[model samples]
Target chain A: MLKRYLLSPGPTPVPEKVLLDMAMPMIHHRTSEFSNIFKEVREGLKPIFGTRQDVLILAGSGTAAMEAAVVNTLNEGDKVLVVNAGKFGKRWVEIATTYGLDVITIDIEWGRSVKPDQVESKLIAHPEIKAVLVQASETSTTAYHPIEEIGKIVSLRDETLLIVDGITSVGVYETKMDEWGIDILITGSQKAFMLPPGLALIALSEKAWKFTEKSRIPKFYLNLKKERKSQLENTTSWTPAVSLIIGLKSVLEIMNKEGLPNVYKRHALCAEATRKGLMAMGFELLAKDIPSNSATGIVLPEGFDGGKFVKLMREKAGLTFAGGQDHLKGKILRVSHLGYHDFFDTIIALSSLEIGFSQFGLKVELGAGVKVAEEIFKNHLGV
Target chain B: MLKRYLLSPGPTPVPEKVLLDMAMPMIHHRTSEFSNIFKEVREGLKPIFGTRQDVLILAGSGTAAMEAAVVNTLNEGDKVLVVNAGKFGKRWVEIATTYGLDVITIDIEWGRSVKPDQVESKLIAHPEIKAVLVQASETSTTAYHPIEEIGKIVSLRDETLLIVDGITSVGVYETKMDEWGIDILITGSQKAFMLPPGLALIALSEKAWKFTEKSRIPKFYLNLKKERKSQLENTTSWTPAVSLIIGLKSVLEIMNKEGLPNVYKRHALCAEATRKGLMAMGFELLAKDIPSNSATGIVLPEGFDGGKFVKLMREKAGLTFAGGQDHLKGKILRVSHLGYHDFFDTIIALSSLEIGFSQFGLKVELGAGVKVAEEIFKNHLGV
Candidate 1:
């Protein structure tokens, strides 16, 4: 009998506890009971965001918060620097361009980490740059850019703000928001937060709030300035995703019990094992430099059809992993080790990969990959 | 011991079955399973919206879809007629103004509906007006506007689109999107859909879609044209509220079983009973001209203390109803008879209202309201 496993970077498996917490009868969002819960959620999120600033919880996907970050921080025709390394980085360029911003895009290679020196050069070239938009860990490519270095560069510029897409990064790694001087950071519920994907969590620095006050973009639902005002009163500006927020409270409590550092270490161990295991299976690692602990991308071997392989995994073993996007489609696979996952899941994924290879007539290493993973797990400090 | 009941106008109680559907094991949104369900939801919403056009589901509160309707169908500096009747109507003005629309507002009384003649006169004076925004039922005042008549007027103008906020109206009343020539219509999950408040359902006519193409508003997340393109491929432009969408599938099935006509009749019967019941207890209704079937707004008697009465209901009887907003605060109370509610619920609400009245040191006729509601239920098609 085969067991079903969810390994998608997005919509990661939610803890059953969080699911049950959300499943309980929903209370009115306008009530004091919910307000207290929301207030707690707001405060709870600050530690994870590594900020003392108020974090805004929105009733939409992560893209909604990303859009909120863009439209609420820059005015029309404002210039910005966007690092386009992967899918989400491209999204930053897209959103900025869509909002009539003059974007100076630094097009880095896919699956490659962006150099902060490149941003420094571009910012130097564009004196009017209002913001630097990038992802902490690009989910599509599993590449972690040096956001700390980028934050250092942006912090030196009085006119420029740093906005990080922490969708798959926050709980998976130590995203030192306040420490690194990140002006705006965004995350989603379904990632390392271990909840459903409806709620978008956003945190802004005091500088970002100032930019929000000056931003002239037309917004009603995603107006963070207004949201900030209502949040100060222990309520949301609009009706939030009540069930998801309740789930967030419970999930945050779980993370608190596990502790943020331990959560990061757990995800790191799982991701490292997965990456090492894939390499042992004769698969090429997608991100050669600074691979993310959030998810691991693998380049399929020559003559091994990726689309057919993924379809086979799902049909044969009930295993679902994300396939490549854009130009890399049918050439790579991504296994998510983020959120509510551990070494056991990594072993299962490796076993599933081996089964997929043998079924496709590719050379089978048997448990060679799992053995590599086992060695790493046994030797890992925390484990 | 008192049983808890949810009677808020927006976040009406979710059916236990629907909640269970949401609580079931979460599924990947990118898979065929979720796509099939989304397709079903798309088709199911068309009838309730009274249109053949595909309704786009957004992962946000109804206000997000309202902003989408405004931003996706109009350009900057476009003249529009806003019917400022109540809170929701005022929202139309706020969104339009936020997007830099040249708004010609028809300011009506808080509890009143817009007169089409006034709109017609305004349209005649302002020939450049591109759209007219109004609500089917204003939740705050519990008043139903003359959307049918307004639709007739807007339909005559080829340059102007009719946008209706059906958040509290769609399943509660006959919106008639196609029959009445509504160019845009929107609804929320927590209202007539009998689900949590995360999914916003929006539909656009061919004309509205055309407007969407030409709309010059700076938008990224609320872009409907992008959403429509992706929806054609059986997916959303972004990750949606998957659990709520799953719950939506079940709730829509329940709604289909009840039938739109029967649902409307049920809401009508309940609202009529509630209004009559309140009046029987010597309390006057706030909505004098056109009371809505979705909810009932009652005017507190002089020196009766509406706030104290609502608080008493919650404390002593475990009942929750909506207090007034803005100018109506502490003057009126709103009782919702929207989705997942029945005649028995109406009786319970009436009994709770009577209990609250007596507890607040106001003269009560004991079972006067419930008796009236019970009599109406007995005479209705089914008790």
Candidate 2:
């Protein structure tokens, strides 16, 4: 039987060590041992989030944290600017509007980054805007938004909190929340944490914390203030996903041992290899100039269904690649090299893609993509 | 060093097989393999929940599912009869009120079960009440509400939907969702499922589905309609906690092999043995006559601090027990004999508790509790 591989952008491959760590016998969350582990995880996440403030852990996906950030910080009818460049970017608008916020969307084209000027103009035009929401890396379209520039502008403005969805970027990219003036940074365990999805991690700056104080939008389970108060004593406000927290601690330990710089470099190397390999296989990139290091979106050749291609890769080659979402479906295939993936995984993915495309009646050179990926790996590894 | 044990009501000790199952390599959610596993899980949950309706899974705690049940079935200004028997019961009211629902509380004492007559009277008095919310087993006070009676009453009324929080009781107690006329039965992975606390599982009946048509509450992530649409195809509306789902699948498999009837019997036997042992040790039961088979709530002996006693059991005996929440704090210690626990675990817990209580200056005969627990286990096991 062929070995199955998960190459999806969000639920990336978990490290063997993290899996082993999670396999340990469950510990009581109320006990000191669990508290000690939680303390280490909370402190460990601080440097990774690039913030000194408390990081809130929720037993939900990244979307829950996003909802929490909105409900806890923005009041009903509060004006907010949402930078919509992709599916995830649009989700911010959807959630904000659902919470009865006055949402002003800065509509950037799909597969393109949110320009700093567009964000600045939106903020300038709407002085009543209490918050600006954007995605650091839009997983749906593989677009890396200009978060630092957006954060800087929002930071200079009074009362406008900069909320960033760092789901696909936190561990793979440099998301310096405090340094970049991002008021709220949200990520999940699945993406770059090298763990299976269960926990949503979020860090809020003083500015965002202040916004939470007067926010009237009602919330219960995802209340940031209650979570923060409990987390101060190294405990979750409610029952946490204990096994996932253990997995997170193990992944953070690995990340700490490798160092953030090395982790970022590794992701960049994988992204470079995947892009080079796909380009060598005569594939056109969807997000051309500002592609995300988290995932590489490839436009299928004319007459080839990207969704069918993804299915073929999974069924024939045992490679599970992500198909595009919304409008991008059947047009592009997303190849993720984030989290526990490395050069070898990239080679396998490219090889699988080669087989899939060829089998699907699209002409593609066999081993051409793998060879390019190998060359890139060799260059990076100095072999 | 002695191995640690979890005695918390939720986030119970995960079965080793469940952890191992979750540790398996991640699979893409959209793939056939995942869909197959998800389908099996959904089917398995039906027997456990005793519901024929579709069971939707969400990546959050039990509260998320509770929120989903409310937001999906109740509209703004909807009158909901909330039976506040414990912390979780009050939570239903809190969440409903947060969503702008007019909530009428059937306030029962913390350690007492909600009376069926109280619910019936409230519903009769408030003809506008559209929903009746209560917990099957309130984890906070270890009281099992009379859900069957409440269900029967709610079923008699055409417009009032019965929503039961089966989080701590689903797998531990005998829950017949369809037979008992429970419109919406909600549970969490951590409690009776014997997995981590990330996945919230909810099953809705035709009545609940009809109520959803008129629900006007704003919801995104916890929207049951969206979840049902995706779940019919064995997929989630959003990113799922893949590992937790895998763990849940394994747990359900274990439950299937053991059989749900046998699982419930085992939990009942364990709870009986634990309660008998604590009683033999001269400890008073906090929940009194009507108690949850999920956990045994024991009142600390006079002058004994519940927190310190729990700490001693955890630190010195390497046994972790749950201290009571809120009003019961420092007054009661809860010993959970819920999912994944057995006869031997009960014996160990009783022995540890006896030793811890004696060490903390409580008057207790050495080995007395253990003897009682052993006798009960022996009788149940036919040894």
Candidate 3:
């Protein structure tokens, strides 16, 4: 029997402890018992979010929270700047346009992060732009954009807000929201939280609250103001995905044990190992400059189909990796080391890649990547 | 340790098997293994929905599916009739109105269901009503509408479609979607599904598919055509709530073992016992004519606080019941006998109500209601 291994960018493996905790008897969300747990989980999210503000939980995916951020903070005719670098980055543009926003899309080339100067120029060109929407870590390209620099640039504008989709970034890297002047930060449960998708976590600063007060967009299920009011009372505005939040509490407890610095460092090590492993196999990364410490995107070698390679890995080796989305489709494969992953998982991922490449009739030595991953683990013992 | 029990109308207790299955391990949604499982789950949902049509799985709550039904089935500014009986029914009006539907509300009183003849009369008067939005079971009042008769009336009109909020109904009662000519039927993973709230299951008929083709409402995340196409390929369009769908498969398997008729019988027995138990304690039901067979709503006795009674049940005894919403708040307590509950649970719920009332100085006879529940169980067993 082939052992199954998941290396997808979003649904990274869940820890057994968290899983078992979620498996216990379900508790009603309105109870004092659940309210206390919700309170603890919210309080614990502060360091991971790097914010003093409330990190509210939603019952839907990160996309829902993305919609919530837009519709709750902007009016119908307001102008907004979207940094479109990858599939997720393009989502912001779509959501903005759907809400009748006058969108000024700063389309960053696929697989490339936007330079802070590019965004500043666009904002200067369109002073009416109310918010600058971007991805902290573009999942489609495994590119970590310089959100810190963008935050600094956007903060210079009195009326502009910086909204970051940190779906795969938070808990994997540093996103000091309060200090960086980031107005809205969003994340999903399936990434660094080591839980399944269903819960979207978003935190808003006092500056963002100011935007909500004047926003004229219509919203019901995704009104962050309503959700925030409910969250302050240690509850959700509506009936939440109760089991997922229980799992979230368990995951946050585990994150608390590791601490923020160590948690980010662990992700950095795993991602570094995976990237080095793929590069040692003579494979190029899809990211143009800097790579994310959450997932590694490897460009398919000549004559290799990214989709076929990923499918073959899953079918033959029981290894699951994510293929590219949108413009990058059939050209890149993304392997995540975000949560419940270690240096050893990088080795297994590399080994599967090596075996998969050889099976596809490409002349490459098997274990070359695995050896690199092993050495990185040995060298980073202290880290 | 007191025995903890969840008797809330929405987040009814999760069956251990389903919870454990969800907690087992995380699987990547793109993998063939997961796709195969998704296909099986989709096919299995037909019998549960009482339809031969495809049942689509969504990653959000029932409200999302309700929104999907509205935004996908009708164009903006299309005239629609909403049956506003309780909180959830009013949700349809809110969603339809938010999406720019010209809403005509058929207002049902707080604790009553809509009459089919009245709906027919309204339809005859306003043939321009393109859709009728409603709930199969109004959770706020525990009132079950005559969905079968309403469906029959709406089906006679070529231009009109019936959209149902079966959130707390489908698995609790047999929703014969195909036979009753239901255009759109929706339900959630919680309630009678024996799982937590995260996934929403919706089925659409052929006429509803026709509506989606010409609908002009904007939708990105809740796009059914995209979701349906992906499901046919044995996957989801977006990153679905993978763990919850896995749990749904497990619950469906258990339901299959019990058979739909038997499952309905179980819910009927539990709900009947709950109603009789409360009635025996001289408690009045909120529903005027017919109460939902899923949850029983008991009106507050003279000088009794519904909130205090429920709170005392949770704190003193480990029992959880649902209080009212909107205008009915602090006036009614909903005792649910949905899935994952049995006759013994009905006894516990009544005992808690009795004990909670006595402890709150309401002067109710303890064990009087539980005695009726015990008798119901014994007589049903043919003992």
Instruction: List candidate 2 stretches off by more than 4 Å.
Output: A359-361
Worst 10 contiguous positions by lDDT, candidate 1 chain B: B308-317
Task: Output the number of the DockQ-best candidate.
Answer: 1
List residue ranges in candidate 1 displaced over 4 A: A379-383, B381-383
Cα lDDT of all candidates, in order?
0.88, 0.86, 0.87
Task: Report the C-alpha lDDT of model 3 over B1-383, residue by residue, as the tens digit.
Answer: 98889898878888888888998879988777788889889999998888988899988888888888988889878999999999988888888888788999889898888999989988988899999998998989999999999999999988999998898889888779989989999998888898888888899999999999998776777879988998888888778899998998898899999888988988888888888889889888898877998899989976678887778788878888899888888888999888898878888888877877887777789899998888778967645
CAPRI quality band, candidate 2: medium
Residue B66, model 3: Cα distance from true site in angstroms: 2.1
Q: By descending lDDT, how would the candidates be arranged? A: 1, 3, 2
Native contacts recovered, in order, as a fraction for each? 0.73, 0.76, 0.70
Superior candidate under lDDT, 2 versus 3: 3
> TM-score: which candidate is best?
1
Clashing pairs in 2: none
Best by lDDT: 1
